[model samples]
Target: MTEAVFRETTADPRTQSVPLSHLSLELGHLYMEDFAAGPERLRRHFDEVRIWVEAARASAARRTGGKRPRISTCFLIDDYFTRFSTPAELVPLILKEAEEAGLVIDYLARESGCAVADRIELAESVMHRLVESPPPGSHGSRPPVSRTGWLANGQRTPTTRNALAEVTVWQPPQETAARNHSVFMDVELWSEKDGRRQWSCPFLAAVWQLARLGLLRHLGEPVLTPRPWDGEDFPHDWDRLPPLLRLNDSATPFSAYRTCTLVPNRFVAVEDAVRLILDQTDVDSGALRQVAERSAGEGAAVPAAVAQRATYVFYEEPIDSSLSEGT
Candidate 1:
């Protein structure tokens, strides 16, 4: 009798290989507050970001041993939290201001894409992959402690249920990696409203970072693939545009070995929380190994830890009186 042949094609998933660049540089990010401040605000933002763009390119070149690096620049718009204007009216202004500032934005993306892109629940998949960093004295006996819809750098103070319980002193939060003192930060991943889950900004930003690093996949296929834009007019509605759009035909690939984001100082806290989330996320082992192998083969080895591969520049906020007030 012939030997039996069996195969499970779906069991082994494969991630599609994307063209890699030495660095994926983020020129800037715009939120509803910035947009409300008007076109002048955007012009000021690009002017400040242009200096850092050059610096980031130089840094990437040094990391590649002075080799000409394939770098891509992208911008993110806040269409998730609040939709201020239509893409048709807003995109052209952004491109024009960026060009005037002597900068080119190769790709444009919407913040909502991180939550869901092309019918894929990207944030939910990322949540499932989170493997928290176990605290000291963690034995295999207890399940990993996690606050639902929240991530913290260290253990939090226990909650007391009984109203008659003895009053306990407030305990200061601690950072897991703190040396002498703790600078703890607890980030909210999501919130439930009317049975619908709303992802937080920091959480979405973490997903964005993973995408740029080529570490996100839905059933082994890359998520949030950039759809080419033919330089025609943008759709009147934001939803009509793909989650990620490639604006420049000659630009390098969106995903790369490393990423650098430049934003205003106001986003420093949010970005820090993004790092905390990224540091603990356990990405697909196959995808992780593929990136490591390919990057090393090109003589540009990336950081062993995913969080370390990202860099950020927090520049001064534009001098606008309206920006000083909360939106």
Candidate 2:
């Protein structure tokens, strides 16, 4: 396997200004690039990146616990690739990399290292693991234990399965409301099976597709928030979404859903554009009042401050009463 190389940069002289999350995000982008390239590429990148990250972590652990920290890592391969020979390969890759990172940090710590230096180093390592590991287990769970076999000493036991979900919002390109790859596309996807492509299905199919893609591999049910554009009629009228938009696997905001037009255009940097639009708004999102009336049940209440700025500009009329009921 080709090895990954993570060359260390000059230590930031100013440490207080950096956000670890931001660093993780930077690494996340780099990891995404490797993922898009190929598994061999990802493996090589992970090997190199894991060493650099662990070196940092080891430095930190020295200052904090005079010990090394081990990151337990795993990867979920896209299900469509299961039949292929390489589908099971990522499991060991993650395990090996995690072990290597932990070892590197130990070596770094034992060498001449200052607390500040160690902290910076360790922070980098943790961020590397964060980026290397898929987003925290946001998707649901593993499949069942086989059809139906349950018992505690011959007594039937209940078998449970967790639901997986996410919210993927879209942003549109400045010029038009058309779906384009330049403006959008997942940041990265593995190209196994000789560049085999995956198709996305709508509604339940969409959810199933996400599960198959390893995108919905969260270990728990997600806590969904209404999109800024979600109004009483939003869920009901979701069918009006473009065919591509209809393939959403989460409770993504209408604006975000519509942003898929940009995906095809390669404008996946929707966050940058959204930030720009938010800059133009005088309305304070944090202090907006609740505009919609309350629905019955023990659902979480929408904070008035947040609700005030919320708008339903894109939703169509409710077509399904079941959907409108908001289960």
Which candidate should be chosen as best, given TM-score against the real structure? 1
Give each model a TM-score. Answer: 0.91, 0.21
| Per-residue lDDT of model 2, residues 46-150, tens digit only | 444443444443443443345332221112223221222221243234344535544211100000011012123321121122111112222323222121111
lDDT of 1 by residue, 1-327 (tens): 899978898766777776778899998877888887788999999999998988899999998889999999999999999998899999998999999999999999999999999999999999988887655644544344243787878756544355577666565555668899887877899998999999999999999999999989888888999999987889999889899999999999999999999998999999999999998898888778989999899889999999999999999875677656886
Model 2 accuracy (lDDT, Cα): 0.23
Q: What is the lDDT for 29 in model 2?
A: 14
lDDT for residue 186 in candidate 1, whole number 0-100: 79
- CA deviation > 4 Å runs, candidate 2: 1-43, 51-74, 81-83, 86-90, 101-327
The lDDT per prediction is 0.88, 0.23
Query: Worst ten-residue run, lDDT, model 1?
Result: 138-147
- Residue 68 displacement (Å), model 1: 0.4
Candidate 1 lDDT score at position 81: 91
